[model samples]
Each structure stands twice: as C-alpha cells, then as structure tokens.
Target: MKLHVCLSALLAVMASGQGVQAATPDAYRDLNHNGRRDVYEDAGQSIDARVDDLVRQMTLEEKVGAMMHGSLPAGDELGHGGAIYDLDQVGVMIGERHLNSFITRLVVAPRRLAEQNNEVQRLAEQTRLGIPVTISTDPRNHFQAVLGASTAGGGFSLWPETLGLAATGDADLVRRFGEVAHREYRAVGIQMALSPQADLASEPRWPRVTATFGSDPADVSRMVQAYVEGFQGGTDGVRPDGVATVVKHWVGYGAEPEGFDGHNIYGRVARLDNASFAEHVAAFDGAFAAGVAGVMPTYPILEGVSLDGAPLEPVAAGFNRQLLTDLLRDQKGFKGLVLSDWAITNNCDAACRAPTADHPQTAKDIGMPWGVEGLTQPERFAKGVTAGIDQFGGVNDGAMLLQAVRDGQVPAARLDEAVRRIMTLKFQLGLFDNPYVDPDVAERVVGDPQSRAQADLAQRRAQVVLEDGGRPLTAEGVKTVWLYNVDPEEARRRGWAVASDPAQADLALVRVNAPFERLHPHHFFGARQNEGRLDFRDGDADYEAVKQARAARRSVVAVNLDRPAILTNIRDKTDVLIATFGASDAAVLDVATGQARGEGRLPFELPSSMAAVEAQDPARPDDSAAPLYPRGYGRGAPRN
Candidate 1:
C-alpha cells in the first residue's frame, strides 16, 4: 500500500537497464510469441505477475503521476498544431515527471500528423516502464469542428455526426463507425478516444448537443451501446484493435437549463425530474454495461449533493464522492477508470487565478464556491483523489499535484489505486504488448480508403432532409444558394452557388457557428455583452445574412451548423429550418437535395428568447419552453 515501496522496486529493476523478460503472473505475456501482450489469451498468471511487478516498481510520485492525466495542447510550437501543451513539454513530463496518460486537443490534422506520431513514439521511449502514453481526443470524424473555426487539421474521413449516426438507429452501423474510428486512431498511435458523448441531446440549445446521439433515452442508449461496442470491440470484454471509449458527464449533465454546459445546481437535484434522470441514466448505464474503459464527470453539481456528500458545497462531480463512488462505482457497477475533466484540480485558488484566454474567467465570476478563489491547488488535487477521480485531465498543475502528494495531503495508498487502474487500462489496451505502431503499416492503416468510404456513408446517412413550401428542396430545379458563414471554398466545392448578394438566389442557406464567446464569456466581457446575446436580432454575421435574405424576397433555408436551437431566431424568416447540427458539406448538400431525411429532432428545447434562457431555472424539472421545433420533430419527404 505504500506507493514509494513499489516505485523503489521498479526504479531498482529499471535503473539497472535490464528489460523484464518471461512475464510472470499479473504481468503481460506474449502468449502467441508475437512480442505483444495479448490480454485475450489465457495468460492470467503472467498478467497478474506483470501487474504486481509494475505496482512494486512504481514510486509514490510515479504512482501519483500515473494517476494524473494531462493535456497536450495542439499548438504549432507543441508540434501538433493548435494552442496548448507542446510535444517538448509532453516529453519532459514523461521523461522527467514520469507521467503517461494525456487527453489531447490535437485534432487529427494532416499538417501535424507526422509530428504527433513521432511525439507519441518519443514519449513511449522516455518512459522507463515502457508504458506508451495514451492519447485521447474529442470526436473528429465529422464536419462539426467549431464553426468559423480554422480547418487547419487534415480533413480525415467524414462520418455522420453523432445525431446522424443515431438517426440510422442501426447498431451495426454505429459499431462499424466505431471500428473505423478505432482503426484510424490506432493508425495514429491514439490509445483512447474521449468520444461518443453519451449525454442525450435533451435540450436543443446546448452548445455541445451536436456531438450527442439524440433526444430520446432509448435511441441514445442503443447508440451508446453500439458506440462502445464498436470502439471497444470483442465479445470477450476486450477490444484488441480499437481505442477505449470514455462515457462522459455521468447522470443529468445533458439536462442543464437550456442544455448549457457546466452550470451549477444546488443539492443532488437534476434539471429533469426523477423520470428524466432514469432515462438519462439508462444511456450511461448501457455504456457501462457494454464495458467502456473510462467515465468522465461534468463540472455541474447534481441536486444539492456533491458526488460524495462532501460538505464543501457544490463539489464538482469530478471530485464528488457520492457521484463517483456511490453511484458510478457502487450502484452502476462501473469498474473502469474515472477521469476528471480538465483543470478540475485548479478549482483551488492557487492555480485557479482569473481566467486567461486559455481558461474561462467566467468560471471564477459565477460565484460558485468551488471557483479558483476558494479552492487551492493542493485542495483541488486532494479533493479529486479522495473523490475517486482516477486520472487528472487537462492538468495545468501537475507540479502542484506532485508537491501535494509529497506533502502527504493525498494518501500514497490512494495514489497507487489510481495508478493501478490506469496501468490496468493500458494493459487492457495491449499497450505493453504492442507499444509500437508498424511504421510501414501506419500509412495504410491510418487513413484507409475503406474507413474514408465509411465516413462518406456516414455523412450521407447523417444528412437531414428539409422541405420548403411542401416541396422537397432539390438542387436540380432550385437555384442552390449558399449564404451565411460557410468557408467559400467549401461552398464552391459542393457545387452550390455561393451568393454574395442574397437577392439573387431562390433559396438562401444560412450557417451559424456557436459564438465561442458564449461558452467562455469572461474573456470578452464588454464585447460579449454587446454581441454575445443569442438573440437572432443581434447583429451576428449569420443573423445579418438571414435578414438580408428576408429583405430580398427570397425563401431562406437556414442550416444551423452548431447547436440546433439557434434556428429559433430566424424560424419566421426561414422557409425551411434545417439543423444539420454540425457542418458536413456533403451532408448539408444531401440534406438540401432531400437525399437524406432530417431525422434529428431538437435535442433541447429552443428558448423563445435570451431572457427565457437567463431566467430559466437550472434546477427546473421541465424544459417545455417553446422550441422552433420539439424533440423528435422531423419531416419525412421522398428523396429527390
């Protein structure tokens, strides 16, 4: 139980430069002589020995480091291509700090693919345990990158966004999509995927709903199961080739008022009543039943109860004992690893300073007791560990966590449990057995043509069919027009007429990106107040396009590429309000042509106005606000 004892053993063996051979019980064994530890084989004795050996070799600090999950910001300097932690920093963490797991924001773009691949390999080499750093990412196979966001990453295969995949309601398709995703991820050395946001799209306006499967619990459940099964393949409770799926925001995260992200609530009350909670729980429950490898908690408070009934007031589910231990572990029987959302440890004041552009300042302003002002770095880290968060994600304060453990604020025994869970997952992933990707096979496997085909199929399947004036919209007869907020190049490639002047087109398609300011408001206080209001009347670029179309005597077809609820503002001006959810040019075109039916219903109710959203109760049981369209409201029309 003393974490340092295990680390001393590991350091003694590894420091001697003697590679472990002939795996014993609890250790990974190459049963097939393939040099990869195949967990599927009956190598239990070896597996147990490896597990024991690993535990014995880990130091308290190393064990704690194993439990700490961090982020790799994909900035140009970091070598991946975005902004956050870079590759060199990642190398330092693994080489010096001995950290392993990381959740990455490096969307699989073509430019940085080589660099990222090299970095993963390098990180593996740096670790004395031969533990390959597991790379995790958000959903990327579709067109739903942040609207107006830079399309810098290499466009990988385009699958149906979560909603589109859900519309198919075909578990097999979902599974196949997951399988394809696994192939792509493994090709790129990605070990884990923070995907298939199992949160039901219960509220339409929620900014992240586009990433969800759908509104109905049943549909969401099936899709969740299929996603897990596909991502973590094998009927034998182990996926040999796929990345592990992390089911997220356990219980009622999707039910936030108007489906907003990260809003707090008092007591263990859910925005939806018990009935709705049951439905939501069913979806997450199904994912657990399907045997996902990880679970993540949202930043919201459930009812008045912090996860563990901790007296600290509104403890984040990430550090809530009741939520993680009582519900997720005990009741739901989730035995996998538990990960904290990014910077949950920074909830304390030392690391929780006023938000910069990188961090949301509004989190501090929200008067939530758990804000950076009240929580210290050590406090946040201790709270998270005690609350049963096995891994720290997007960790900006790894040094603080290390220091806290050294000071004994966090128990060494607890740290080992976390490390054990993490190593177990790595073992389950067969990482020890197959730490290296075949460089020759990398190109073939990374972006396979078949996977691309699957993506294309998903894109087509995900298309939403919209009708204007009782007639299905078709490209043949209609003067296909592209309006508001699309990359001009994308519009042109799709064969749609990109109109600078709204008056010239018969149908005006307006695309709206979710205002990032809305998600992270403090950074743009004055600018946000003036422009961040979700009102369609606000002079948003997309809003202006719709108004222009209305003035031109043209029938407007509005396609909201972000959240579906943005359609409420221009519902009156639009001849057809098509919520493609996310931007997939192919899917958008297909939806326009009626080749794909709009099966996606509003996941959350669209508030009538900004006031309705502001005044809405976060703890309210009902979300019956007047939506442009209700949940499950879809029009079926014959394909043109």
Candidate 2:
C-alpha cells in the first residue's frame, strides 16, 4: 500500500511537469499587442497547431480536470460576495486543472483591477501549456445586484437593461454596448460572457425577460447578432482581445409554462409544440449565424425527444444526446463550445425538492422545483458529458468525477472528448500564444470614457415616453417626485422632490422591490391553505400602494428595480409604467427629469393578474388580453 501511494504521488508530479517544458518561447510574444496571440506570427503552424501540441503533452488526468469549472464560496468574510472574484477563482481552477478555458461570475471593478489581471497571468504561467484561462461573467454593465455585488458594490458602471436596448431598434447601439462590455471584460481578464440572452420574451411573467431584448423575435434576433458582433468585433473571426459572447438558454427557456424560473417543473410542462419551437429557434439560429463562441443549454426538456429515443420524460437538455448532438451540433451547425447552466446536471432532481430560502416557492409556482434528491452530482456530470456538455459551470464535484471515472461510471474517451472541445476553444481564443495583458493598456481601457458615454447614450435612448391625461411629459412640464423603498439618498442626489407620501405628489413614483419573492410564513400562508394558492405575489404591497396612489388622480410611474416582468402586475394601476429593468439611480433620475426619454417597452407581456399568469401557456407567445398597455404603449409626452 505504501509503495502504491508513493508511485501515485510521483506520477502526479511528472504529469504536472509534462506539458510545461514543451511550451515554446514564441508563445509569450503578443506580436499585435492585442493581449492575444497573432495567428500569423510564427509561434507555430497556427494557434490550432500549438493547441494540439500542448493537448497531446497533457495526461488523461489533466485533461479531465480541464473540463471542470470551479467557483469560490461567497462568504461574508470576503466583504459582501467575496474578494476572490469569479475571475480569480477561474485562474486558480485553470492552474489546478491545467485547463485553458473556464467561466466566472465576476462583476467588474475598476480599482485594484491590476491584481485580478496579475492572478490570471500567474495561473497561466503555472500550466505546462502556458494556456491563458478564459474567465466568463454575467451582465455587469448594470447597477442591479440580482446575483450579488463585489466589495465596492456601487463602483460599477450602470447601463440600461436589455429590455431598453430592444426598444431602441438600433442594432448599432446594441453592438456598441457589446463593444463596451468587451472592453470592460478585457480589462478584468474575462474572455467570455454568458450573455446576450437571445430567448424571445414569449411569456410576460417570465422573471428573466428584462435580461432579453423585448418580445419581438426579429428584434431579439437582430439585437443578439449585433451584440455578438460588437463583443467579438467581426463575424468572420474573433478579435485578438475581444470577449466571446455566449448566446444562451439555447431553446425556449423563456417560454416555460407560466413564465416560471426553471425550464421544467411538475405543474409546468412543455407548452411549446413544433411550430412554437420553430419561432423561438430562429433567435438561436441567428446566434449561430453570428458565430457565437459558446452556447448554454436550458435545464428544461422538449416533450418528445430523448437521448436515444429511450422515452425519457422531461429530458435534460444539458445531458440529452438528441438535443445536444442531433439538434444543436448537427442541425444548427454550432461548431463552438456548449456549456451547461450552473449546476444544471443536478437540476432534474434538485427541481423536485422543496424550494430553499434563496430560491423561494414563488419560483416553484412558475415550474422551478426547489428541491428533489434523486440523481447524485456524479450521475448528473456523467450524463451531461455523454450528452455533449463540453464544460461544467459552477461545478462542485471535480474529485467525485475523477472517482466516477476510476469506478468505470464515466469512460475515459468521453472525458477526452470534453477536454478536447474545451482546449480547442482555448486555441480558437488564441490563449495558447499571447496570454498576458499590458497593465497600462488595461488601465487605459478599463471603464474608458467613450464606453461610459456610449452607455449613457444607450440608457437615454432606452427610456420609454410616459403620458398623463393624454399629454406627454416633456422636460419642461415634468415635475419629478421620487419615492424611496429602501433609502432616499441616491434618489435625492438628483435634486428631485422626495415624497414621503404618494397622495401629495403629481406623479406617484415608487421604487418597487426587485421581483424576488421570499417564501416566509406570510408568503406560504396561501400555500398551506391550498396547493393552488402556492404562488406568491411579488411586490404586492408596492403594487397596491402605487395603485392606490394612481386611483387618487395622480399620474403614477412605477420602475421595476429588478427583472422588468414584475411591472406587468401593476401596469393597469398606472397611467405610465416604466420597466427600468435594472436599478441605475442616475439613469432612473434622468428618465424622471425628462432629460432621458423613456424608450423601453415590455420584453414580456404584462399579465392581467396572478391567476391569469398561472393559467397562461408557457410555450405559446403571450397572446393574452391586450395588457392595459401594450408592449409599445407608453406616453409619448409628459403628463400634466
């Protein structure tokens, strides 16, 4: 036993050093100074050649490690979410795994940013292949903290949500927005963004609708293409330092029955049939045409198909062979990487379990099952890989996966295939050659003035015009009244009159809660009474408060502080409703002052009531009764 343990340790050490000595000095040269390798430079036959050479030098264990993407725990000790950002974690994971590619959940920070870049560089040096790690992030150009914020929470630049961008109908502005995000990402060592959510807002109550471009399929497609072009710079090829866009939720995740959180739940089944699938598939088709670098599968299943037509019920798309191999790769011709959503492998069983404090029962009513415990993490991972998930996002079971392979649950060849796909993406990203960023260039590009100006312009264009008594609220006629839900400091900074009571105001402006429903005793009161009453109404108090104010002959405007869908419930109560989608105190104030016109429209339909939302078809387009106000229905001028 002692001899075997010693031999294993020796083998591990040798494996770690195997690819390091093979790296050529030319790999360090960024000939174009673009923070990436120049394919034309004589580093090797091509970036592909270098990638193949390095991949060949790696051991099977290293290859398997490469497929696992890991994130650090967000404890209070690290400040708010953590000092160890997702990019930093990705860097560490790459070094530990000897993998060139990974994903991150990082929110960009301008200060102490150099340290973040240095950590990634250090990790790249540790790997034998010297492959730079590609860190991915959520949409960060906004001020909302849905996914949580960093240590200096308020420092990040706030941009208008995608809902607003869609209303502009300007592909150029959307493209420029992507470019700005690309610049910010490059500064912080993020190479991929799991964004440009192309899913058409088919359901009005879907919580994530604000993340998308409004309800129009064509508009969604155009905006996605523009975003992809802006992030990658050119459709023909990726820019040297440009961030790769991951057009996501591959299928109609947004159309899940009743506009729920998860793709599948016990009550919420697939409402989309063949025709519905075709309409929603158009946006993904457009993303593929744009040559997007990555695609993420939704956790929901299509009703009919299976891995091998085994009659699998609620087929997990992340691990479903028919969907990933047959549809995505073959039919759609997506040559880029396909990543699973965060812990999607465990979603099937997890969805079955009761909702947690973080997730809440409201998500369950929408088909997001809170908790179920059937499949283990290893089982999910193996299944996902067989189905063609190239990389694991928010993976927690790397060691378990290694154990599963040793136990013969996962085949070595399958693991190799996953590793190859990841490595190929790294090579395609040109990380094998130029993996370092110039601190000077990063500093200059970090939150560039031009990008901020573009964000401000985009924010202004995204504003939707609201009217009172048939008169549009123009800048001259607008008398702003700001209502604070949490604190008035941010709202008061804009010099608007902060109202303590809505009765005294011309416009009853209330900052509604971000649509997060907590399943406390009060929330579960109706759930205990009847299963039908399980759904929790989000922002109920705020909605009723605003409604009361509107009934008192005041022009009311309610701004959604989170995902814009929550605005649907209060649409009828107000003369003008603005789905600001995300919180940007400055941008919100600008819109209120008429300095920035309201250009945003509903990405999702505004459901008439909670019961109506629960009864609506998840897969079908929102063909419900005309919302008290339609998607494009907003006041063209300020109301008196």
Candidate 3:
C-alpha cells in the first residue's frame, strides 16, 4: 500500500529550487512511507513547499484524479438518498484511482456521520500516498431540501434560510450563523462547504432565491463577506480549524428567463444585459474580499453579456474563458480554485436532453453540457481546463482528462498548475495532519443546547411582519385559537386553548407557502424545483384556508416566501400578514405571540400583481412597478 516517490524525484524538486529549505528534524506522518521524513510530510514546511513537493511526486493519473470531485456512492447506487457510503465503491475510487476528495451525501446522525467519515479516512490512510480525503457538502443547516440546491438539517442546529438571514439585516448574525455551521460541519469531518451563495435574488421567480442573501448587490456583498469570514474562522484565508467555503453561481445565475433554472436543459440561458450583469457580478465582491478558498461557476450560459464591447462566447460560465480567466482571475484577482458546476463535462444524451412522462427524469439522467454539447468528453475537459476551472464537480472520470492531456488537448503545465492549487488547499486545511474526527465529540457538539437556542432565537427574529390590522396577537383577550397548517401541541404548550373548528375559536392562525407551479415535471431538477407562478389565487388550497380563517375570525396569516409572491389577493383576506423564510411551527408561534421580537424587514419586494412580476426585469432588484410591500418594509407592531 505504500507508494513512495523515488529519491531522484525529491532531488530533482530540490534542484529546481521551488520553495526548498534545509531539511530539518521534525515530527511527520511519513505519508509516502519512504522510510524517512520527506518535505511534504514535515509539518514545519510551508504550505507552498508541501504542495510543490506533493505535486512533483504525483503521477499524471493521480494529478487528474485530484481534479475530479465525485460523490461518495451509497451501498445501493440506485437509492443513495441520505445513505452511508459503500466501502467497496470507496475503495475503488480511493485505492485504485488515487482520488482523495469526495462529496458525502449521507444524512445520518452526527455521531454516525463522523464515524463514517473516519472510516473513509482510514481506507485513504491505507492507500499508496496516504492522502486523507477532504469531504465536502451542500448547505445542510437550513430547512429547505431542494435535492441539488440544499439539504435538510438532520442533527445540525437549524437556522433560517439564507434569505431569512438577509431579512434580519445583521451581518454579525450571518457571521455567527457561519461560525455555528462550521463547528457542526467540522465536528462531522466535513472540511469544505459548497455554499454561502453570493448570487443576487434579482429574479423573484427563480427557484433558488431562498438560498440567496437577497436581491440587493451591496447587501448581498456585505452578508456574503461576513458569511465567509465566519465559516473560514477569520477575515483572511481559511485557517486550520476553519472550513473552506465555495461561494457559488459566479456572476449572474439569477437572471433565468421566465424564472427557469439552468439545472434543466430547457433553462440553460441566463438573460443578462451588460448593465444588469455588472450588478450581478458585484454581488460576489464580499466573498472575494473575505478570501474564500473556492468558487463554483454558474451552470447557465450568459445570453447578452459582452466583454470590452465585443460579444463573448455563448457558453456556460464553466467553459467560458472570458468570464473565468479575464473577469474573475485577472480583473478581480481571485487566486482560488475554480470548481465547475456539476456534470458540465458529461454528455447530454437523449434521456438527459429530453425526458418524457414515460421516462421521468432522475438524478442519474442529469448532464449540463449547455453550449458545449457538441464537444466530445475529452474536448470538454480541455475547454474547461483552459477556461480556468481547477476541478470538475460531480464527475470522477479522470481517465478522460488524462487522455486529453496525453492527446495534447490540455497542456501538462496547466494540469500541474491546477494540481498545485488543489494540493495547497488540502495542506492549508491541515487535512494531511489529521482528517479523522471524534465521533463522540461530534454527538456532543452538533446541535448542542446552546446552538439550538441561538438558532431558535434567530428563527423568531427573522420573521417579517408585513401587516397587523387586527387586534394585537399579544392581547390577552385572545385565548381559544384555531390553527391551520400549525401543530396544535405548540399552541397548547403556549397555554392557549386550541379550538377544533375555526368558527368556535376567538382567532385563527394560518400558514402557507407562496404559490408555485410544477412547470417541468419530466425534468429531474425541474420537478424538484419550485418554479413558475408566484401568485396565490382563489382556488388554491392555501388561499382557501386563508379564506376560511378570515370568515371565522380575525386571522393572522404567515406565508413562507421562498419566492417573492404576489400577495395583493391574500393581503385583502387576512387582517395580519407575516412573511417567513424558514422556521419551525413553535418558532413562528413564539413570534406571533409577541414572546420574541419579529422585526425582520422584507429582503425583496412582494409584487402587487402577476403583471408587475412578468413585466419586471429579471436582473434588476425592486423594479416592480407596483409592489404590495417594498424591500425593507416591515411593521414591528400592530397597525391601528
């Protein structure tokens, strides 16, 4: 299992005079099992020296394997939802292919998750180079569970969605949230976070708005910077204890035409004009300023964007050199790894390109080649590498990339450069020193009492009170409350009597989600995504519940604003209207009962009508001609 670099290779690296220092006696892991301490194994060496040493020892196959960030397959590949990794598959990926990084999709308890990651690291320790695996994950500290967008909080402390964080308008709170999330993630052996999305929520209809800070570029920038600082443990680059963050959907991914997402073939183009596009790019300034370790290119192809008065290439951000190289790296001075969005290099076959009712699209059928569909797999690899992408996400086909390098499609120097960046991060993260986490400590740290208390308080403070026309919810006169879409136990716990029927209660409370359409039921992500309409019409079940509550008594209605819904109709039905990003039934009830502060402002405008929403520009913020409530509007008290 030991694979040591020859003495000649070490001597050659030393002769090159790249980060070479006098070899000193130091405690080391002997990762290469070379019978003596090597430069990379020495903890005393600089991260740059260690990266250079490691990269020099890596073969072409190993280097290519380093560039592919694949998923940790479950025991049953067909049903891998929140399942533990299959050790057999893990061995094939790590031992045979030399892959040392993976995205863990397991949604088990904190202790079990930590134990599983430790097991994977043990297998990696037995490998040739003994490079520990760096496990990464999507946002898993929130309530939303849109398959590819975010995961549900299982044992982690549950916070409001990113939009809810924006609603609080507190950068410090957002930073605290990141700190808590980082502690929980690292407790379970996750070294990287694929989150803190800096994309502006400009397009209200976009399904991923819930994951963003808000629609304002400046606000998003401020929050994004705090998020990075909190997660990375400082205002500088990632520290040894910090989790490396990957701020995502670089540039303008929120400007999808008609609110369609790029995760599906039909929604691959992000319509961005030159002026509006600049605003979208400005949103990521905070992440850049915070020295984030990684950036993920958006999946959509920029439609109307240009560079220096010339039309740019009509391709996705991952395959666009103008965007990645010129704008991000050269102009913005981003010296970090550029990870492509998932499956950008895979071929879009008939099933992926067009799924029918008979063959509904599944996760396996996803492949987002976009404008580069005509390119071969090897050609796609070459194009992405030249475009400045350091790693291909959601794919483990390093053989294809290796072939491209051998065929002269990708330069060996460029491949080496990418390998250096990847290795540098791993060294900086202290993954080489120790990648295993304590399972017992993980159970004690993840979702501890103190963290949950803070999270619950955050949930209460993040609720936006749009209107309070009826008697104040704090009034002691109200006793018997009728609940719809709320747990009766929560009301009972508040010492309030819960009425079985709406008519028998003194007041009624209702909860509903902003209306959405299953527009693309046949597509994988499209089916899971909450797309299309943001209006709440009469016939809808949620709207009916509101109507029934209003008819019974003064109703206090709270709606989950995952998308900026047109509340002109619902506004008239209920006496009180409140907006929430993501909160538990108890948290909402606490806010409603004046037990906690609920002064959060609207992060985005609620359009007055569907006409205003459709007529508005997707890339512009708060541009609705007539909005029911403008951004930053919220009432802290009951209205007269």
Worst 10 residues of 1 by lDDT: 11-20
Error of 1 at 436 (Å): 1.4
Please list the residue runs of candidate 3 whose C-alpha ends up more than 4 Å from where it truly belongs after superposition: 1-26, 75-79, 637-640
TM-scores across all candidates? Answer: 0.78, 0.78, 0.95
Backbone clash tally (model 1) = 55
lDDT of 2 by residue, 522-599 (tens): 222222211222222644676556665663334546466233343454555676555555545566656655556766
Candidate 1 lDDT over 529-558, as tens digits, reads 212344565666766776777643345454
Alpha carbon lDDT of each predicted model: 0.59, 0.58, 0.84
Worst 10 residues of 2 by lDDT: 12-21
Better of 1 and 3 by TM-score: 3
Query: Order the candidates by lDDT, highest first — what do you get?
Result: 3, 1, 2
Candidate whose lDDT is highest: 3
